[model samples]
Target: MKTPKITIDRIKKYLAEGKRFDGRKPEEFRDLEIEFGVSKKAEGSARVKLGNTEVIVGIKMGVSEPYPDSPNKGNLMVTAELLPLSSPRIEAGPPRFPAIELGRVIDRGLRESHFIDFEKLCIEPGKKVWTLFVDIYTINDDGNLLDAGGIGAVAALMNAKIPKYDEENSRVLHDEHSEENVPLTKERPISITGYKVGDKILFDPTREEEDAGETKVTVGISHGIISSMQKGNETDLDTEMFGEMIDMAEKVWQDLVTKIEKFIK
Candidate 1:
């Protein structure tokens, strides 16, 4: 949906005063909620909501031959679908640019952080290995699907359990389950996205604010380190602005990770 020029102007005006149409401060984020085991069929599943924006992620595991270069490690794939029902801006079709970009950004955040111990996923060295597939679905698009989807994916993986395998029969025993959890690293990665409007920067922008914003920066943090970063839209951000964005991202991530840990635990 195209936002009227007047609305854009109003948003920019409000940002100048550190206020939002929803009465939130420029740096304030919407309420966040995470629920696990939302899907019975999925090995692991979670639904996350950031105010009105919502995303669901499912994790499935399968056995496959290991990659030639990384024969000792398993593989992970992430995919996203922005359902038309979620918002008018999204269309019903195969995954498009937005969907692919969202998936890749989230994938990079997790993979680069080494969040999962891929070596533990190998069923046999240089042979059979576990492949994890993360599927993300957007249920609502009030705004900031990237953060919501990333959180949902991580939560789903945390809630997942490995299924029992019958190596001799070369089959997965669906009815059996492993008592251990998936191998994961100590660091927990979270993404924080900042939107630039005029000369002001804001966090957790609503759909309206996003429509008015000119640029976006998404920073992924893990163990007090930046694992990855992605910039979106066409806009020039000076070094000072970039530094400010990362500082804000780090502060936000500190708070968010605490909440996520409590929920996952």
Candidate 2:
């Protein structure tokens, strides 16, 4: 739903002074909480809450023939479902544009960052490779589901245990898990978003604040390096503003990694 013009004006007014209704700094994020083992049947699963926004991610593994281009590497698939129960803005039906973009942005980040050792997932040089499905479901949509889902994805992957393969039958034994875990490295990529309102850029806006913003940028970063970035809401920005957003992303990344590293490690 669109925000009321009066409310938008009030939000922009507060942003111009570097203030918000919630009394947080423009560069500050809401409280973050992560929970593991949400699904006993899934190879890995986690639930993330960013303030009031909530998302759950599950990892399911299978065996498949390698893709022609990457015959030696395994495959990663990311999908998202924005349930109507999560918010009134979401409908119960096929994925809309936002859901598709969310998955793609997260996938591009994880894929390009080389967070997973795909070579280790390959059971055979050119024939058999493990396939991982990262499924994200929104339980609430106060705001910032994209970043929350990304965090949940990484945490779930970290928690995943590879399932046993029935090589003789060319299938995966979902009921049985192997001692081996998903081949992931120490790299923990995080996604941070900056919302633009007037001349101010803010992180982790509430739903009302998000609705009031003109546009936003989401960056996938690991350490100080950026892996992927996506802009949304059809607003134009200059190079200087983009640079500022990058700076904000890096700082926010550091802040978040500090809070989540204990669980990740």
Candidate 3:
């Protein structure tokens, strides 16, 4: 069922008073918390919290042949599952469109940004290469699932440890005696999300604002470049508003990136 019009009217009144229904300012965001390497079973894992919304990401690396089209590049796969346990709205079984879209967006942001050193994952060229699989699970659905999932995936990837391989045989070997945990390279990318509510904007929206937003812009900022961008809703955005949003995003992105990166194991 949709939110009652009376409730929305109250929210509007609150906004006009420079307050949020959840008791936050127009530009304030909910608290964020992160945990890295939370799972021992996976190669890497992380848990992220944006207010009440929660997400878990796991990274698994294995030996596989590279795709024919991009033989030189290692495989990187991202998938998101909206667990029915997370929220009553989530259906059981296969992933829904929203989950798929979230995964694809995060995947595009990382891959297109060249955040991971795929070339370094190559073992025996096209014959064998390391495949990075990132699995995102929604454990809670208060709101802002997109940002939570994206940050979780990136954190998990950063915390991942590559498996030991036998250079002599060109295969992943079971040599516990000589095994070593190959840490990821030095560089990592960061992402930022901005929401446009009425004529105002905010960084890292709260659960209430996320649900109330008329439009949003998610930008992946990495290595002095705009790695990726996703715009939601058909609401028109003027040049001035767009510029203001971008400016706010950049300022907040610096702090968000620092905090998230610090949790990289």
In terms of lDDT, the best-performing candidate is: 2
Candidate 1 clash pair list: none
**Reference-based lDDT, each prediction:** 0.89, 0.90, 0.75
For model 2, how does the per-residue alpha-carbon lDDT over 9-113 read when each residue is reduced to its tens digit?
Answer: 999998888889999999988998999989989999999999999999999998888999999999999999989999998888789999999999999889878
For candidate 3, the C-alpha RMSD (Å) to the true structure equals 2.8
- Cα TM-score per model: 0.97, 0.97, 0.87
Residue 32 C-alpha lDDT in model 1: 87
Model 1, span 1-265: residue lDDT tens: 6888999999999889878899987777889899998997788899999999999999989999999999999999999999998998887878899999899999989888989999999999998999999999999999899999989988999999998899999897755777768899887788789988999999888888888889999987887798889999998799899899899888888888888888877
Ranking by lDDT: 2, 1, 3
lDDT of 3 by residue, 1-265 (tens): 4456666566666676777767776655577788987886677789999888899999877788999987777889999999999987777977778888888888888887767878877777778888889999999988778878888987887667776677676666433323334335544455667777767776666555566677888777665567788887778778788888777766666667777766653
Model 3 weakest 10-residue run by lDDT: 174-183
Ten-residue region with minimum lDDT total, candidate 1? 172-181
**TM-score of candidate 2 on Cα atoms, chains taken together:** 0.97
Q: After superposition, how far is residue 7 of candidate 2 from its true place, in Å?
A: 1.5
Report, for all candidates in order, the number of backbone clashes.
0, 0, 0
What order do candidates take by TM-score, descending? 2, 1, 3
